[model samples]
Target: MKQVDLGGSGLNASAVALGVMRINGLDSDAAAQQVLETAAGNGINFFDNADVYGDGECEKRFGHALKQSNLQRDHIFVQTKVGIRDHAYDFSKQYLLDAVDHSLQRLGLDYVDSLLLHRPDALIEPEQVADAFNTLQNAGKVRQFGVSNMNPNQVELLQHSVQQKLIVNQLQFGIKHTGPIDAGIHVNMSDPRSVDHDGGIIEYSRLHNMTIQAWSPFQYGFFEGVFIDNPKFKQLNDELQKLADKYHVTKNGIAVAWILRHPANMQVILGSMNQGRIAQMAAGANVQLTHQEWYDVYLAAGNNLP
Candidate 1:
């Protein structure tokens, strides 16, 4: 697929990323290898992972699969997140340092292309985080840094001290979950869609040139389930099918295309472990939906323009 500048970091990455959160569920290392190879063959060079995914089992599996696939380290960009502990968020300097080392060991790599704070820690000390980042960068353990599930203010709080530019903010975004888009469109309105839940993070990211990585692009209601063929989203599925037929792609491809149609230039993280499904979703990068078609799909997802 298509490559874009990740924020303004000068790092060119695929518009679609293979999220390895669920790779641990695969039946064998060869299966995981196939999934990763299929994605790379389709031009997906970005891989998203987290220290806590499958309790770190996913990262271990991915490392093994990568070794088996014979893919060079420089060919792909690997990113993982930290800061999430067993029950609380920890961004302490020591924790951040240890977390990157653990992730590196698990991934069988010298350093990650990027490291992110999985979630904001309410008791975060920006100075300590900055120190940790400095140590990591100075030691060549992490090339870039970012945050996830954070509002604009929280990003600002950390940016004030961290020397590296926070280049990404991963968020849960899909056709059915359009809080960021809703707040922008419904500006100055008295409707519920006008409520600013993310502290104008969408606008902030755009303004600051931070890439918003859209995670779980097919799921609705926070992992309640995928809405692609669910009866509850009949209207959405019907519209997706109509576009899929027009584009000669599967409904999943249409779902991915709808996310890429946005002007934000955000990366859609695909969490599928199926090799065939991975290829199908990656094809979405080639389908450019018309503006009307994009809006049609959006509205079909139970959202109103207001």
Candidate 2:
């Protein structure tokens, strides 16, 4: 897979990241190691997980699997999101600190390559979050900081207190659910349909040099079935199939290629447990979609090209 700079942080990670959300259901050490080893074999250096994923079970399984595989810690970039617990959002200094400790203990690691605030907490106190993040950074517990599903203003609010650069902003993105990119393409037109809901989050990331990690790169909607073979997504799938044939790749691979083709330095977080699916998506990183082909897929997503 191709390597991309994780923002301007001087850290390079794979453009395709293997997300461990489904690892919780795997049997034991060997089962989990199969999933992880498949990722490593594909040259995917980035592995993303969340403390809330399987209520911490995912991290535990991943930790055990890594140890069993005997993979070197320095050879991979592992990230996990915090701030969601007990069905509530918590970014308070105490929760952040406690959560990091628990996460480290669970993952059996001394540090995480990056830590992200999973979701925006309406009740967040930016200073408290900053304090906890600073403590972690100073203690060598976390190497970098980021946020997920945050708008630009929320990022600005947190930036006021955060001394470290927020290097990444992971958000949902795919050919079927293309709001982040679509909003930019159709920004500020006279028609209400052309108005955006994202408030230019994509543009802001590009301007500030933050990497945009795309989660759910194949889902038609939020956790809905993938659009790759959905009959309702016939138009989109037709174009995707053509691209797949043109490039001699799988349809799922073409779906991922659409996101990698972007100029924002994006990372596609693949949420698959099947090892073959992992390899297929990783191959998309090698595909460089042309401007015409990229735009063609965009139009197929039901976005008008004004």
Candidate 3:
């Protein structure tokens, strides 16, 4: 896997990261351990997880499986998210503190490499969040801080008061979830494409040297379904297959390659629990698409350049 500077945090992270959101879906703990080993053997050293995934079963599985694997904790990067509840969001100082402590306990770790606020809390008090971050950092519970599904302005709001530099923003982005790219390419046009749905987050992250970790790199339309191999996206799949043939990788790998081809230097998080599938998709990080090939794949996905 290709290594990129994660949020310019001075940590070299694999461009292709394994997301353990569905790890609990595996039939057994041994299978989960195999998943981690396969990913590590394939050069993926970054892992993404959340408190709410599988209602914490995913983290538990990952932690248990990780202990069973041969890879050591310091050899990989682990990032987890918090703040989302049943019907509300919480980023209060106490909530943030307790949440991270619970996450560490579940993961069986003293500290995580990075911690992220899973979503924007409407009633967030930036100072309280800053205090939580300070406490975590002071106690050696977290090494880095970030946000998820937040617009640039929202990020700035917290950055304004938070002493620690916010270095990452996780978002839903892929060949299908192209809102960030669309808003940039459409520039002054009067189409929906021109609407900045993410408050120019893509550009903002680039300008600020913040890493944008792309989650659900294969899904389309708010988890409607994956577009790869689906009859509804025959043309797109065909294009992907052609590129896959050229690169000697799977069509699924091509989808990941397309996201890696962007100049934004983003990281891709794979949600696959199957070892073979994980290796195939992580292979995409190794193939660099040409400029024309990148746009060709983009256009085939039912998009047009303004």
Estimate TM-scores for all models.
0.98, 0.97, 0.99
The residue-by-residue lDDT of candidate 3 on 202-245, one tens digit each, is 88999999999999989999999999899999999999999999
Worst 10 residues of 1 by lDDT: 67-76
Residues 1-306, model 1: lDDT tens digits: 888798889889999999999999999999999998999998899999999999999999999999999678898999999999989999999999999999999999999998999999999999999999999999999999999999999999999999999999999998878998999889999999999899988889989999999999999988999998999999999999999999999899998899889888899999999888899899998899999999999899988887
lDDT score at residue 69, model 1, on the 0-100 scale: 96
Candidate rank order under TM-score: 3, 1, 2
TM-score of 1: 0.98
TM-score of 2: 0.97
State the displacement of the C-alpha of residue 115, model 2, in Å, after optimal TM-score superposition: 0.2
Give residue 255's lDDT in candidate 1 (0 to 100).
88
Q: Which ten residues in a row have the lowest lDDT in candidate 3?
A: 1-10
Q: How far is candidate 1 from the true structure (C-alpha RMSD, Å)?
A: 0.9
The candidates, ranked best first by lDDT, are 3, 1, 2
